[model samples]
Target: MLYEKLLAPLLFRLDAETAHNGALGLLRRANSRPWLQALLAGRDRAPEPRLEQTLCGMRFRNPIGLAAGFDKNGIAAPALAALGFGFITVGSVTPRDGQPGNPRPRLFRDVPNRALWNRLGFNNRGADTLAGVLERQPGLPVPLGISLGKALQTPIDDAFGDYAYSLEKLHPYADFFEICISSPNTLNLRELQEGSRLDNLLTGLVKKADDLARSAGMARRKPLWPKFAPDMPPILRDIALTKCRELLDPAIDAVVMGNTTIDPAFNPDPAKGGYSGPPLFPKARDQVRGAAARLEGRLPLVGNGGIFDGGDAYTMMKESGCPLVQLHSALPYRGPMIARRMVEELLQAMDRNGVRHVSEITISQPSRSSK
Candidate 1:
């Protein structure tokens, strides 16, 4: 209440990116100091055993995760984990280091809609630096998922090499690998999401992951999930799913339902960036449910976009058949405590329905005859 009524107003006064960086800086400092982190960690960091979920062959303390864009460089991940997210996904880390990304003012705050428009273009310190950062932590409090993307200048033909290189360097450090082919900011990035191109990309990636896993002596291969864009046409989405089932290796795990959307409807302004937060929830839910129906329980889905509160999260899981859901934009509006609030709300919903595990909330899959 204090943050919404007072501190948020002060923070909102700064440019979107400035405020974000400032908050991140504070979080980084707090995280660096064990005493400060513990002082701030309080109840938001507590665990609800009932909300624990097993997905992609790993146990998530809870289903709410900090989405990829939130920590593009893997900086402050330990701090974010201390804030109570069940897991933390860091980096859309590219093959090379120190990519400047899109020009500044790349992030905008849509106050009325409780949303954000970002054209960050996978900006980060790159995979090698990220590996070093992760190495420093050595033991993260939560399961860590790494999101991989090609450099903006990397041509579509050479994209496989970019992705493969990053995966090879970082595979030993991640619990799962998310191939990001969405993000409307990069030039022709969405083109990689096309059926044939995506298949080629994943085929190469899966093989690379297998090689890395063997050399690393890892017991099992890390889960590989492709991050998708929510705005894909129905036909394309179905085709994409078919390609997923056909091309993805059996060792590949689940699919992340989406990244930010480029739909103009969500951003009434003329800005050319992806829209996230509340405006994205409806379309994202529809896509999640659609994917669930098509997948028919064969694969688990991670629901994302516009998840602000527990009801929103619960509804997303129920209607979309997602066992786990993620939030990015919500954190800015609702504050760092958002994850704990969401978990509490989701647990309440679970209690109302007499369910224990998160997976019990299911949506019926459309039958083949109906389709």
Candidate 2:
């Protein structure tokens, strides 16, 4: 109530990137003050078993995750986690040497339609610095997913070493890894999502992970999930899924069905960046639906893009078959209390839909589906 009525308006008055940095600074402050975080969270952070879900053998307290690119350097996870998210993904972080990313005025608000245009690219402090940051981060009640992207200077052919370097350095901090090859801002970045390239990247990553696990004497390596684009045409979508089917188990743990959409309808100047918000919901859902139908429940799916409320989350679960979903632009429209509200509303939605829990809404999953 207070956020929308008071704080959000003030934040909106700033430029998008400035507001974002200001928000992270606040979260960093909260991270230094546990009591303050709790006060802000109120009764919102408490767990609801009805929303509990299992991915692989791991349990998530809820389905709502703060999407990657929000906290690009793993700087605010502890405090963001305190805000009642099931998980927080830090970074679509690049390699050892970080890149400056795109120029100023890269992030814009499509406030009228409740959307954001971000061409910030993958700016970060590099994985080396992030590893140190995560080392000091206190453990949170929820899972933590880290996104890996190729270094800006790395050529397309050498992209493997760049991503592998990040994975190896940050492996210990991540509960699951999100290979981010779908961002529209990076030049030729989406090229990695193609069939042969996708196969090699995932295969090499799983192999590297296996070696790392063996060296540590751990039972299993961290889960690796590749993030895809929402606006992919049928043929391209199939190619990506085919690569996924080939790798599913020890190679790929799950799949993130989308990044943002570059559709001109969603943004005034599509080249500046893609859009994330309400208009992206149907596009993201439709893509997830098609992928689910094709994968036939072989691999679990994470849905990201324009998820604004509990109804959006519920529909993603029921119609699109996504058990896990991430929110980005909603924070602007709905305020910081969004997660708690979404959790409560999703529970109510489950009851109205006649399901006892989120996992029970398995209409899209096939007989083989478990996660």
For TM-score, the strongest prediction is 2
Q: Which digits, one per residue and each the tens of the lDDT, describe model 2 over residues 1-371?
A: 88878888898999989998998888888987978786666655556888887775467899998988989998889888888898888898998858888999899998888888889889999999999999998887788999999876788888889889998999888888899999998888899999778888989998998888888898988888889998788789877887887776722388888788897765567966988899888888888889878777777788888799998998887886677889888987786677888898898898887889777874323333332
Question: lDDT of all predictions, in order shown?
Answer: 0.81, 0.83
**lDDT tens string, model 1, 1-371?**
65578778999999999999988887888766766665554454446788776666677888888899788888788888888888888889898684889999899999989988888888899999998888887467788999998898889889999888889888778888888898888889888889679889978887788788888897667788898889888888878877776655433377788778877765565364888889888889888888877766656678888888988888988887777888999888987667777888988988887888776784322222312
lDDT of 2 at 254: 80
Work out the TM-score per prediction: 0.94, 0.95
Off by over 4 Å in 2: 250-252, 363-371
The prediction achieving the highest lDDT against the true structure is 2
- Per-residue lDDT of 178 in model 1: 86
Query: Alpha-carbon error at 154 in model 1, in Å?
Result: 0.5
* Native RMSD of candidate 1 (Å): 2.9
- Report the error of model 2 at residue 168, Å: 0.6
